[model samples]
Structures are given as structure tokens and as C-alpha cells.
Target: MAENIVQRLRDEIENGIVTNQFAPGDRLDEMQLAKHFGVSRTPIREALMQLGAIGLIEMRPRRGAVVVEPGPHRIYEMFEVMAELEGMAGSLAARRHTDTDRTGLLAAHARCEHSANADDADTYYYDNELFHHAIYTASHSSFLIEQCTALHRRLRPYRRLQLRVRNRMKTSFSEHGGIVEAILSGEAELARTLLRQHIAVQGDRFSDLVATLSQREAHSG
Candidate 1:
């Protein structure tokens, strides 16, 4: 129950504040969160410590936990490392994937296409995550899979924000289409290149989209 509380609190933070609402250098109010989550301060403290370990939050002496917002350079630096990791996973999966992995990835990509065509952003996001997880599983490296998944979880908020960009779902589906084909055809290099490009986050629109969403949230609040 205690761990569940910690996980749930992390989910709330990931979906709420970390997604861009808190922004860079924004302070996290522990008392407010404790009240909102209907839990004692202990679990909240535990959850914040986990987030800090993951580089998603920082603990301060006087102000408690604060959201660690990545600047443009940090975004680029993180994505640069993530790209290599993803590319390596894709490459390995091409050689190591099972029939089951291919089937699941294909199905997920198909659903992503359907969802995007229907303009269902929510469903698209769900299926998109499923597709990536399939690739990670296909890689057949426990260490790589675990590390890749943790980083993916940390990046979820920003990725979710980026997905809301105009026609972003459609573009993502097209990218996935290429990735699926390359992987199916056992084209390791092709899959590697496409996967890295697919997850690339340094583009101008990514930063702009986060800023736009933050502005909207501020105005609405």
C-alpha cells in the first residue's frame, strides 16, 4: 500500500506537473500535494525522493522538492543519448525479435494509424507507447530494456506535450510505419536510422510546443 501510494503520486506528478505545468525551476508544494493526494507526508516524501533519483525533481534545503526543468541544451543532450540507445535497441531487435514481438509491434502500429486517422489523440498516445514498449521488449537485453524504459518514463511528460502539436500524431504514425517496415524486413541499419530520427526531440517545434502549452496552462490557471 505504501509503495502504491508512492507510485500513484509519481503518476500524478508525471501527468500533471512534469508534463510542463510546473515549468523550469517551479517549486513543488508538498503540503498542497499531501492534502490533494489524501495521504500523509511520508509517501509523498518517498515519491519525491524517487523522482529526484531519476533527475525529474530536485530537493532543496528550504523549499522542498522542485521540478527540474531541462533547458534547450539539456533537452538536446538527453535526446542525443536517448537516440543512440533507441537506435541500438532497434538494431538489436531486428536481429533478435521473435514472431510474437513482430506481431505485437505490427498490431500496435496498425492501431496507431487507425487512431490518428480518426483524430483520436488519446488513443494514439496509448498505442504509440505500446509500440515503443514492443520494440524495447524485442531488443532481448534486460539491462538495455530496463534503462530504456526508465528514461522513456521520465521523458513521458515532455513527449506527451510534444504529441499535442499540430498534426503530430499523424507524423508520428508515418514515422512508425517506416520503423515497422524496416524491422519486419530485418533491415537493422534502416530500423536504427529510422528509430533515432523518429524519436528526435531537438527540433524547433518541440521547444515551441512546450512553451505554447505552458503559456496556455498559465493563462487558464
Candidate 2:
């Protein structure tokens, strides 16, 4: 029951941050949050700590927890690191995946396909996370999986936002198809390259993400 409450509070707080209801630099008061959510301070603090671990918020000296506003350059750098880590994971998966891994990856991919076809960005985003997790698991490296999962969590909101861009979900699905093929075929180098390109924010994608962030900030302001 306590665990469930923490998770619910975490999700609600995360959603608030993602939707800009809790804008960057806004102080998150534990007592106020507890009152608003009708929960105790303990769960609210735990949820904020989780968000801080995922880079969504920061604990200040006297201001309590405040939302983090990562700039575009920092976000891009983080994506670059994520792309490389994911690429390495893909390469390892191509070389080391077992039959169980194959089945899991395919199932995750199928779910993503269904969501994409339904044209539901939110659903697709959730499925997309499963698909990436499948790949990380397939890599068979505990360390790589840990690192990838950590960074992936940190980038969750931005990745979901990227899917909201016009035609991005379809494009992302198509890219996943290629990644699946390469990994299944045991093409290590190809899988690495494909995953890198699929993850890295560049050119038009960078512009689209920045524009979306700007729009959200404007509305929230």
C-alpha cells in the first residue's frame, strides 16, 4: 500500500512536470504537495527523490525540491551519450541474444507496431520503452543494461515529446523495424549504426524538439 502510493505520487508528479504544469525552477514543497495529493510527507519526499534521481528535479539547500530545466545543448549531449550506449547495447545484443531474448524483442516490437498503427502517441511511447528495454535485456550485459536503463529513464519525457511531432511515431516504428532486423540477423555493426541514428537528435529532429519545448514553455509561462 505504501509502495503503491509512492508510485502513484511519482507518476502524478512526473506527469505534472512533463506537461509543464510544474514548470522548471518551480519549488516543490513537500507539505503543500502532501496536502494537494492528500498523502503524507514521506511519500511525497520519496517521489521527489525518485524524480531527482531521474534528472527531473533537484534538491536545493533551502528551497526544497525544484523542477530542473535542462537546456537544449545539455539535452542534446545527453541524447548523444544515450545513443552511443544504446548502440553498444544493440551491437552486443546482435552477438549474444538468446532464443528467449528474440521472442521478447519481437513481442515488444509487435506491441509498438500496434500502438503506432492506432496513432496514439502516449500508447506508442509506453510500448516504445518496452521495446528498448527488450533490446537492453537482450544485450546480456548487466552493466550495460543498468547504464542504459538509467539514462533512458532520465530522457523519458523528451523521448515521449519527440513522438508527438508530426509523423515521428511512424518514423520511429520504421526505424525500430530496421533495428529488429539487424539484431535478429546478428549484424552487430549494422545494428549499432541503426540504433545510433535512431536515437541521436540531429538536424530536423533537434529543431522539432526545441520548437516543441519552446511552445510548451510559452503556454506554461
Candidate 3:
């Protein structure tokens, strides 16, 4: 029962089923969710506790537990951090990855190409992530992979949203090709610079994308 309830909660949170219905900083009604899950408050409590530990939601005194949003500035801050981490991964991957690692990355790149050509942005999003993850793992550094993946997960929602930017998927796919070429040539410095810019550059489109998303939500609401 406990495990089932925890997994259910995890799925709901990860799929944005709850967040879509509730705003950031809003308290979660434990009784409501417990009822929805057809379970006692015990597992619900356990789930909330676990989420709090992960920095997803915060448990408060009287107001109850609320989801935390990183707000505006936090988005740029995360990108800055991601740029450095990804640059390091690219640098190491260029020099250290096995031939098989290069093969896996090329496969992921092919998937991205197919998805982009199809205008299947959702599929591209998934493949793009896999491609980046392949590079990170290619570094053969467990500690680096773990840290990079954690940060990537935290930034997942933002990255997911950016996939909707006009023609961004195709542009991203092209950039991925460049990175792959650099890595294939063992150009560590070139790979690092390209990877960092690839992750960090919104290129005059950041505000437009932000505006579009904001307007979209307002309209949908």
C-alpha cells in the first residue's frame, strides 16, 4: 500500500497532473489527495514528506505543504549552472569517451534528426535529452553524471516548455550536429564551447518564448 501510494504520487507530480491544477506556492490539500487516491492519509503523508526532501514541495506549519516555483530569475540562474556543467561534460566526452560511446551518441543524434524532420517536437525533446545524457555518461565519470542528471531533472520543465518555441527544435537539432562533429573530431575545446552555447543560447528569443508561454497560460486559463 505504501509503495503503491508513493508511486502514484510520484507519477502525478512528474506528469504535472497536480501542478496544472494548482498554482505554485499553493498548499496541497492532503485530505483531498488522500481521498482522490482512495487511501488513508498515512501514505499521502509519507509521499509529501519524501517530496519535501527533494526540494519539490515544502512543508510549512499552519499553511500546509506548498509547491515551490523557482520564479523568473531562477530560470536564468539554472541555465548558467547548466552551461558550466554541460561544458565540462563535453570537454571530457571529447577526450575520454570510448568508441562505443560515440556510436551511442550518433544513434541518439539520428533519432533527434528524424524527430525534428517530422516536426515531432515532443519526440525531439525526449531524444535531445537522451543525446545530452549520452554525452554526459560518455565522460565515464559517475559523480559528474549524477550531478549533471540531477540538475537536468530540476530544469526539465523549463526545457520542455522551450521545445514549443518556433522552429527551436530544428535549430537545436542543427546545433546538436555541430557538437557531434566536434566530439567526433576530438576537438575538446571546440566541443566545450559549442555545448555550453548550445545549452545557454536562447538568442534573442528568450523573452519572446517567455511571453508566448505566459500569454498561452493566460488564454487557456
Which candidate gets the maximum lDDT versus the true structure?
Answer: 2
C-alpha lDDT score of every prediction, in listed order: 0.79, 0.89, 0.79
lDDT of 1 by residue, 1-221 (tens): 77877977876776666456566677888788899889888888887787787787898899888887666567656676777889989998898899999898888888888889998876777788889889999999999999888887766656765777887878888888888888888999999999888878424456777577668878888
Evaluate residue 15 in candidate 3 and report its C-alpha lDDT on the 0 to 100 scale.
40
Task: Extract clashing residue pairs from model 3.
Answer: none
What lDDT score goes with residue 105 in model 2?
98
Candidate 2 off by > 4 Å? 1-12, 18-20, 34-43, 201-207, 215-221
How many backbone clashes can be found in candidate 3? 0
Q: What is the TM-score of each candidate against the true structure?
A: 0.78, 0.85, 0.77
- lDDT rank, highest first? 2, 1, 3
Residue-level lDDT of model 3, residues 2-83, one tens digit each, is 6976866754654452234556777888898888878788777887776665566788899898887655577678788888
How do all the candidates rank in terms of TM-score, highest first?
2, 1, 3
> Model 2 reaches what TM-score against the true structure?
0.85
lDDT value for candidate 2? 0.89
Query: For all the candidates, what are their Cα RMSDs to the real structure?
Result: 3.6, 2.7, 4.1
